[model samples]
Target: MVCDMSSDIFSRQLDFSKFDLIYAGAQKNMGPAGTTLVVVKEDVLGKVSRKIPSMMDYKVHISKGSMFNTPPVFAVYTSMLTMQWLKDLGGIKAIEEENDKKARLIYSEIDLNPLFKGYAVKEDRSNMNATFTLENENLKETFDAMWKEAGINGLNGHRSVGGYRASMYNALSLDSVKVLVEVMSDLESKA
Candidate 1:
């Protein structure tokens, strides 16, 4: 199966072998959005009967060492640097552990805090993205101000799921999540 793992690519451990192709944009957990990374098994190519252009051909890209045309040099370099950083942090397995801890911290607070409610089922919750909502919709403005004042941003959820989404990526530290939890607790105190 082809998987678009843009948000959780290197943030968690994954069994890539199960996927025929895996692709991700560098913006979320790797680097900038200009670059995308794709992996495909060689055997899977040439199976399609349709004609594939050289630009869209995976085999062609691979044969050209992923330099078929001018690449986003800066984005590629940044992605390489981020990958190296992840490697130094002991690779995917280690980063997954750190990501899990961060998720658990915020999720625990969401469960404990009466003012907030998580959107996903416990068993299906994502380690990278914690979607939640304020129990009282009116309290959103107050909580937004609180988190903003505490130097927290990007907690806004998608329009379809209008609540909050706290992304605990590999690079996010535990202390950051603690700050969020403290903000949540403070909001609860004021409630």
Candidate 2:
């Protein structure tokens, strides 16, 4: 099975061994947008009957040492740096714990606050992206100003969600989530 783990890759612990192949864009949990990381089970490659383009073929890429063509040097380097940083912080388990904590803090605030409501089903809510909306649509402007004043950035929800999205990546601290929770509480207080 080929798994695209673009949004959820490193933010939480996963059993990667179950998949025959896994790929993820670096922008979410790794680094920037120009690079992607792919992991393939060596034995699974060249087993497919269908032909793939040379660059798209995992075996060829592996044989070429992942330099079949000029690589995104800056993105790759930054991703390497991120990986080293994560390793320094005790690897996936530690990062997963922090991510879970951040998600919980923000989700708890969303659930308890009268002014906000979460988009996703409670059990299905993403640990990486907590999508929520203001209960009073008219308060959007007020809450927006509040979060901005609190120095929160990138809290805007996707166009489809039409609310707010608090992305709690592994690199994001629990303190940051607490600031958002505080902003939600402050907004509710004014309600």
Candidate 3:
């Protein structure tokens, strides 16, 4: 199976042998945009019977060491530096621990704060995304202003979900999560 791993790339590690290919963009948890990461098993190549265009073919890119065309030099370098940063801090396992801590903090506030309700069930919760909505939608205006005044930005939910989303990516600090929880608690006080 070919998996688009952009969302979960630096948060955790996966078994590479199970997939024919995995592709990701280095923006969510790694670097700035303009770079794509592709991981494919060598055996999967040359098995396709159809014509594969040069630019679209992974084999061609592989043969060129991913430098076949104009590469996004800065994005690639930033990704490498971030990967090195993660490694120096103990790699995927370490980041997973951090992500879990952040997730737990936010989810606990979501559960404890009666005014807010989580978008997903406990077992279905994501370690990187804490999606929730205010039980009292009337407080949206006040709560929005509260978080913004607290120096938080991009806490809006996915456009389709239409509530609130806290993206605790790998680079996000645990203290940031604490700040968010504090904001939520403050909202509860005002309610």
Ranking of all predicted structures according to lDDT, beginning with the best and ending with the worst? 3, 1, 2
Candidate 3 segments exceeding 4 Å error? none
The 10-residue segment with the lowest total lDDT in model 3: 10-19
Worst 10 residues of 1 by lDDT: 7-16
**lDDT computed for candidate 2:** 0.89
Q: After superposing candidate 1 on the true structure, give the runs of residues whose Cα lies further than 4 Å from its correct spot.
A: none
Query: Candidate 1: TM-score?
Result: 0.95
Candidate 2, RMSD to the unseen true structure: 1.3
Q: Candidate 2 — which residues are off by over 4 angstroms?
A: none
Error of 1 at 38 (Å): 0.6
User: TM-scores of all models?
Assistant: 0.95, 0.95, 0.95
For residue 148, model 2's alpha carbon misses the true position, in angstroms, by 1.2
Per-candidate Cα lDDT values, in order, are 0.91, 0.89, 0.92
Residue 42 in model 1: lDDT: 91
